[model samples]
Target: MTGSGHRALGLAAAALTVTGAVLVGTGVLPPATPPAPPQAVEASHPSRGRTPETGSRSAAPVLPRSEPRRLDVPRIGVHVPLSRLGLNADGTVQVPPVDRPEQAGWYARGYTPGERGAAVILGHVDGDGRRGVFHDLGRLRRGDTVSVTRADGSVATFVVQSVEQVPKSRFPSQRVYGPLDHAGLRLVTCGGGFDRQTGHYRDNVIVYARLA
Candidate 1:
């Protein structure tokens, strides 16, 4: 999907949901506070500007787009099947069920794995007081590899370009979800310090990767 279209679709809801979860996890908010409605979490962070993907390093040529079936990040010991996620009635991106926090999900409406754009994979940091699939996502570093297996039996490999933790309020939406020249990957989860009063993590950890 075009960057603008993605923004219009469910980006707002996705951002909100991510931020809300982080806040709730840190206990920054009341435990009684209900999770954002199904349509409440896509793209809670708005990106008004765009950043060009630039670097001396170049990723492999783009591969055909395909539905991702599984993900493997050896460094973090993650090997989980992927579920398709679409937008909710309110236009927020769909999220993996909280009850199955160990699973990861892909934004099916957006770029597919190996396509010429940024493919987003989201997972919870924690749920039910246990670690979620992406609990260690922040520990990844540049040069780490993330592999995604597609239904076609092809594996797309991505090399981590950068890993950053930024305040949810200052999330770099354009940079993270914006269109890219190559097949890019974005792994996201909550990070930073937990706010005792609010019950939310103050920051988000994003891992930027490109096809390899």
Candidate 2:
């Protein structure tokens, strides 16, 4: 996707609607009052031409374009098939259906997983009185792994580099969807407190990872 496309998609995805209800298995509700999003800024560490998660100086290898079939986050027990998402009539990005909280959606207009650009995946935090596919997204730490199984029968493994929770008003559009030097992946979901007035979460949780 182009820079403009990235910005648009990021902003649209950031505005996801999340219902603040009891979490499945946890039996806990989100805070009524929204908490301030994290203010930490990520510093880039350049090592030759390699991706941030790797030590090699050589350019990272990229795969040919292929649709992603599934996503796996072993640490959080997330294993779900991916659905193709496109822009809506209003030009906003489409999201996974709230009724199916266990499914994830991939930005079909952007780079596919394993391609030399950021491939974005969006899931709900919670919905339909149950925890969503990415409900535990905030618990992921640096060095965690996320893998995408592609249509070509190859899996693209990515190593988590950073995670951020930012208000939808200040979503990092450029950083999350901008062109990259190597293959990258971004997992996004709603977080922060539930807003009864708006029926949406106040913040978004984004995970940045690079091909490994």
Using lDDT as the measure, which candidate wins? 2
Full-model lDDT for every candidate: 0.70, 0.71
> What would the per-residue lDDT of candidate 1 be over residues 53-98, giving only the tens digit for each residue?
3465354478887899999999999999999876667566566776
Superposed Cα deviation of residue 129, candidate 1 (Å):
1.0
Positional deviation of residue 120's Cα in model 2 after best superposition, in angstroms: 0.1
The residue ranges of model 1 lying beyond 4 angstroms of the native Cα positions read: 1-60
lDDT tens digits, residue span 1-212, model 2:
56765666565444332221211212234322222223423333221322334455277889988999999999899989999987777566777777777888898878899998888898877667677888888777788999999999999999898777766665666666667878989898777767666666667777889888
Q: Tell me the TM-score of model 1.
A: 0.78
